[model samples]
Target chain A: MELIDNVSVAKKANVYFDGKCISHSLTLADGTKKSVGVILPSTLTFNTGAPEIMELVAGECRITLKGESEAKAYKAGESFNVPGDSSFQIEVTDTLHYVCHFG
Target chain B: MELIDNVSVAKKANVYFDGKCISHSLTLADGTKKSVGVILPSTLTFNTGAPEIMELVAGECRITLKGESEAKAYKAGESFNVPGDSSFQIEVTDTLHYVCHFG
Candidate 1:
C-alpha cells in the first residue's frame, strides 16, 4: 500500500550519514513501531538492533548482509531480511524509499 | 506535542533538491494534510502553492518571505508562515526538522 493508515508519527526526522539517509518514526495504533525512510544514492552500512525487514517502495540498491560475500540487487516491490544484532552494506544506485519493520 | 497522533502516513518519501530536503506526507483522520521533513545545512528557495505554516521541531534557520527584505531567525518551537503562490528563501545553518501545515 502507498500509505500506513491510522498511525501516530513523530514530528522530528531522523537524519543519518550527514543526511544521506532520512526517516520518520511511526507508531501504529497497536503500538507497532515502524519507519518510512529514504536513502540517497550512496554507499552506507547500517547496523540493526532489532531484526529488520526492509521493504522497498521505490528505487534500487545492492545489499550484502553481514558475513555474506555476494551483494544482491533489490528494487521497488522487493524486500530483504536483516538479522538482529547484525549489519549490512548497501550500495544505492538510485534514491531508495523504503519501509523498515523492526523486531 | 512531540507527535501527530491518529494520522495516516505515506510509505514513500518526498525527496527534493537532490535529497537536501526529505519529507513524508501525512493525512489526519479528518483529512487535513501535512508533511514532516528535514532540511540539511543549505540555502534554498521554496515556492508555495497552498498557504503554509511551517512549524519548526528542531535546528535553526533564517527565513526571508517573498517580497520581504529581512530574514528572520527561527529555531525549534518556533514557526513561520508562507503565503500561497508566494516563495521564501531559507538559510539553514544547522540541520532543520520541520512540520509543514498546509491549507
Candidate 2:
C-alpha cells in the first residue's frame, strides 16, 4: 500500500510490556489513530477492542487468530486482521516491526 | 502532514545501541525508507550520512545541533533537521519516540 506523503506525529507515550514490547501512538491528518511498535522474541496474546489490521514491517511471526485451526507464518509485508472483542496469539522468533490500524 | 493510506513494510532489523536505543527500518511505497525508534533516558551523539528530519513522536528531548552552543528542548509533535555529514547531541530525560527521514 502507498501512504500519503505528509503526516503529523503524536506525543510519545512509553508503553512497556515487561521489556518485551514497546510502541507509540500516532494520529493522522484525518484524525485516524494508529500505533507502531516492536516486539521481541516471545509468545504473547492480545485482546482487541476494535477490529485491527496488524501489518508486519519487519521480522517474522507465527500467528493464530481466534477460531483458526492452525498458526500461520507471516513475514514483512504481510498482515492479518483480528476481529474486535477477540484475541490472537503471536510467536515472534526475532524482533518484529509492526503497525496496527484500528477500525 | 498526512501519510498515504497504504504502505508495505520492510523486513525487521535489530539495531541496539548498547541497550540505550532500538529501532527498525521501513520502506514506503515510493521506496523511501525511514526508521522508527525509542531512546532511553541518556545523552547520545550521532553522526548522519544523509540530511535527516527527526520527528518526535513521543516524549521529550533536548538537542544540540552541530556548531550550536546551546541545546534546545523538543517535545512530542516537534521536529528538528540536521544537515548531512554533521553530528548532533541529544539528551533524553524520558523515553523518546522518534521517526527519522533521510533525504
Candidate 3:
C-alpha cells in the first residue's frame, strides 16, 4: 500500500471540487473499484449537489444531510451512508477525523 | 435506510468467527460489491491464523498486527486496510467502536 500524508495533498491535490476544496489522496474511480477516503479537518460548503455516505471514525463530526431538518452528529466508529444529489456543509469539530466507506 | 441497534445484534448475531464475535450488519460478499461492516465492542482472540486489518473508529482499541513488534493503536477516523490471513485478537476498551471497511 502507498503511504500518504496531508502534506502530499496540500502540496498537490488542494483543489476545489463542487465548490469545496478537496485534496484527492487516492481515488479509485474506475466504476469497478469503489472510492475510499479519510476526511480531514476541513469545512465543506455546498458547491454542488452530490450526496455522499459518511462514517465517523474518530472525534466528532457535524454533517447536515439533504432534506433533513437537523444536522446529524456522528461520533467515532459511527457511520452514516448519505445519498448523492443533496447540498450540505461539513465541518470538523475538535480535530474530527474519519475513515471513509471501504467495506 | 435500515436503522440497527446493538439490541438487534444481541438478540441475533453473537457468533465467533476465527475466534471472534462478528455481528454482520450489512455485507456485500459479491465480488462485484465490496463488504462493509462496523466493529463493535468485543475481544477477538486469535482462534486461527487469519490476517486482518483493524481501524480505530471511536474510543480506544488494541490491535496486534501479524509479525509486528508492537500493537498499532488507532483513534476514531484513522483506518487500515488489513490483509485477510494473519489471525489476531481485538478488544474494545471503554466501549470502543468502529465502522468496518466500506468503500
Interface RMSD of 2: 6.4
Q: What lDDT score belongs to each candidate, Candidate 1 first?
A: 0.95, 0.75, 0.40
Worst ten in a row by lDDT for model 1 chain B: B1-10
Candidate 3 residues B38-103, lDDT tens each?
Answer: 333566654333333444434566777556667766666566655554565566553333334433
- Tell me how far the alpha carbon of residue A62 in candidate 3 is from the true structure, in angstroms, after superposition: 1.4
Please, what is the TM-score per model?
0.98, 0.58, 0.34
lDDT of 2 at A35: 74
lDDT rank order: 1, 2, 3
For candidate 3, give the lDDT.
Answer: 0.40
Model 3 alpha-carbon drift over 4 Å, by segment = A1-22, A25-43, A46-51, A101-103, B1-103
Residue-level lDDT of model 2, residues B6-101, one tens digit each, is 343333434565536766455565878777678888899988899999988777899999999999999888999999999999999877878888
Q: Which stretches of candidate 1 lie over 4 Å from their true place?
A: none
Ten-residue segment with the worst summed lDDT in candidate 1 chain A?
A: A1-10
Error of 2 at B64 (Å): 7.6
lDDT of 1 by residue, A1-103 (tens): 4999998899998899999999999999888999999999999999999999999999999999999999999999999999999999999999999999988
Q: Alpha-carbon error at A61 in model 3, in Å?
A: 1.1
Q: In candidate 2 chain A, what residue range of length 10 has the lowest lDDT sum? A: A2-11
